[model samples]
Target: MTTTEIAPAPAAAPARAAHLYQLDLYRVITFALVILMHVLGATTFPQDVVSDALETPLHLTREAFFALTTFVLVFSYRSRPPRPMAFWRRRVPLVAVPYVVWSVLYWGYSLLTAEQPVGSVAAALRALGIEIANGTAWYHLYFLLVTLQVYLLFPVLMKLVRTLERRPWLVLGISGAVQIAVTCFLSYPPEGVEYSTVSRFFTTLLPYQFYSVLGAVAAVHFEAVQAWVRRHRWFVAGGLVVTLAVAETGYFVSVHNGLWPELASDAFRPYLVPWCVAAIAGLFLVGTRWAEAGRRGGRVVSWAVDRSFAIFLTHPLALALLRPLIAFVGDGVGAPWTTVVVYPATVALTLVIVEVLRRLPWSKALTGRPPLELKRAAATAAA
Candidate 1:
């Protein structure tokens, strides 16, 4: 669906920076939520040690948060439209460098942990190629891969956004329908059928096209959406609650029937789209109130948000290293309580580690943080 009509792009003015802090709050909260989801995930793998009622809802929240990343990306891009090639030159390196570095790190970790065996250099390279291609080097790295894919076609996405500006519902409707089809087709497969290659590609970018496109439309029309959300704040909040209930119910029913044991746990399930959209809108409205709190609130919130991407890259490692401690706590608190404790502990530990990593030479290439002064000095010396 193409439209020749273009609506005026919204200005991301500097004076309204505080208003944008709501987005930062969303980022920080969602980053923590993702870590929590992964923590809960540990219960189901290799052994089904603990099952919690919170799992489906938390898992869905993590997937829903993908919209925040795209929203921020497109919002920043429209604020300062870059030359297409220049955009790639500047942004691709930020993701690619870290992706390669972390892939190597996770591969080496796998070898040390006996998950992968030592092999010839050529074999190791080949294995690494597969891991990077499938975003299997680590659990969370797929987000980087997906974002990179989206970045490659970002210009075209913006163009589509421009075309649909006058008819925003058309944008959401098309992307939403495709997302639903993709989600259901992928989630409810025939028994014992394999689609490894297709699954990997789906994991990358296509399933999330709706979120990215809708995010761009939201970015250009932020004020209008924000105003509508405020007027219907209670309705938005209720919608989120209702959708989450439906999703959780559907997931439990599927598991009880033994159809696809945890099929609905997959992030892209058709039921999750409504939940994601509602949750984001509800949270955005709540976050704006927090943004208006005070200067200290702003600093504290922004500080955490600034480190979120870095935290995302480093959190899995944090989770791995903390497993022994988690096991100890789990013995006493039980697995569910362990998850509750694990989420914040991991977040705190990851941020501390990331702070140190950010100060090290050339470490942004791994942590996804902006290079600090030490890195700058190292670069100057190398030059």
Candidate 2:
């Protein structure tokens, strides 16, 4: 009599997953920053005093891109069924073809221009198998190699992350501790710790691997991060401001006072941890809430997002065309403002070129396709 028939309260509608457009816009913005960093990095601005002052933020910008890459990869792969072989098959061609093409281009250029006895074709082949001493383009290829390593390890890492996500505070505490330890260890080197390629690889790869794994783990608890970001946007902003201020202050104090030579030279590394966190938080906030706020962002964002992969692949050739101008402009003119102008110009020009090439008859193969016509023919034959 007290309760006629107490019905259970209806479950709340499942929270709608955020739109992909938001992530897409974030990707475009981050990639544009990556392009800017590369363009400026290739110039001489980083070594100058005023430029160094400006370049701290730019350095953060680039590391933020790398951090975003790790973050996005985690988000993209989480809960997606594992496809290890498919992953390799897709990424290998994307990475290997461009790498080989660029390697040869650089090798040929070196042979034509260098003063020393350059390696023969046979030697070049051997070097490529084990090392890439003469391949300037190989600098960027290292990330591809590292990304492949991360992909290979992802399934195992994902399992661990799933287990950890249930106790997010525990996961964060452990990861943060490990990251701090690694950073501290890296901050100081023993006398015999040579700075050769092998040593450098081990040092850099170890820390980067930790961050990448942390990113994968974080993906599992992204909802928690999203919630925190929403509630503490100002706190996040304050964290960023504090991080940048400390970084900039350290840079100037070191440059002027000539204290902590190693620390000063390696200021970029300290900023990495803070900047990565801030960028991820910033992107999450914008992506979840503000992605569609601006009118100009809609079509432009869509275009940039669609073209990002292709543009990343082909933009180096465009940069090569501009290298002569960059060289002529000299170190004096390679300021942040110069880069602010040139980097976007280069990206725009590259996008235009790629668009034009897409319209050509044989453009498909050059751009990693068999051709639209060939695809149709294959479909018909299969049917």
Candidate 3:
């Protein structure tokens, strides 16, 4: 489903001294959307047209997160190149430990919640092994495994970025076309098509190779990219509105034409590619505008950004714990609209979980962050 290609080599351009507050805004906003998507998926009536449409658009957040990770990476590494070994030693554990930790955490939860008992300990252990390899310990945990792949390949990706400095759009054009082809295949797989499971293809960057390169290439072109996004902000806004309507219309039409609800709402379809592009542009613009307008989020956004990893890791737990209490309230709103009540409650509880985890000694291993330093907090307060 993916085509991996490299651009020709050339010397790199020096990175500009761009402010990062915009990316901070961009990343954290996308993180919030991930939570919302999860809550909706867990709570909403899947067959409902309205709810199903929402899922299609929201699925872009996963790709957006991948782009942002590489965007930040390319910019940083370009500014200050990394020794591959040191970069891996430092970065891999950050994602790997949390990934393993949460995979076990969720796998265990699934076991305990299952109505049918596991026949034996060996079977359970084997299941866990398969779950981790398949990245199905939890649906969302695949992002971590895929991201770990991104981090591992970033050195190579960064070199690719440098090589394409002389022909920025060439790399983007190649990646974008590859992505479209991939989407087309996913949307219309050949009859009797099969995907590998033991080493699931989706758990790698193959499914999202375009997005992996998108962020990196964007970072390579950050100064120009930022200037262009900021300049065409209104265009970005208009494109988002237009693309969203088209995506929705296409989904309804597909359903009317006898497509299954699953295919009609599958986020990987070509109908939403432009929609995803526009939404990403709009998100980047808003983040950039916030930064340009004095970056007022201050501690609140920073705090949220700080805990986002933990929230990403543990929000399902928070949601699970709160479901019994919220499930009844959802009945009043009706299942199709249940997300209205459930999403906020899940977010609040997730925050509480993140706060508790932040206080632990091994916070970084569990949460991808260390304990907040009093001096830094004091400084933020003072500033």
Query: Could you give the C-alpha RMSD of every candidate to the true structure, in order shown?
Result: 6.0, 7.7, 5.6
Give per-residue CA lDDT, model 3, range 246-306, as digits (tens): 8988898998998876568886878888888788888889887887777786568877787
CA error at residue 343 for candidate 1, angstroms:
2.6
User: How far in Å is the alpha carbon of 89 misplaced in model 2?
Assistant: 3.9
TM for every model, in the order presented, reads 0.87, 0.77, 0.90
Q: Which stretches of candidate 3 lie over 4 Å from their true place?
A: 1-19, 195-199, 373-383
**Best-fitting candidate, scored by TM-score:** 3
Candidate number that wins on lDDT, 1 or 3: 3
Residue 45 of model 1: what lDDT? 49
lDDT of 3 at 125: 91
TM-score, candidate number 3: 0.90
State residue 15's C-alpha deviation in candidate 2, in Å: 18
42-85 in candidate 1: lDDT tens per residue? 63442241253455666644445557766766666655555789
lDDT comparing candidate 3 with the true structure: 0.79
Candidate 1 ranges beyond 4 A from true positions:
1-19, 43-52, 61-63, 190-193, 373-383
Query: Over the stretch 113-144, how does candidate 2's per-residue lDDT look in tens digits?
Result: 66888667788667655544332444454555
Go through the candidates in order and give each one's C-alpha lDDT.
Answer: 0.72, 0.58, 0.79
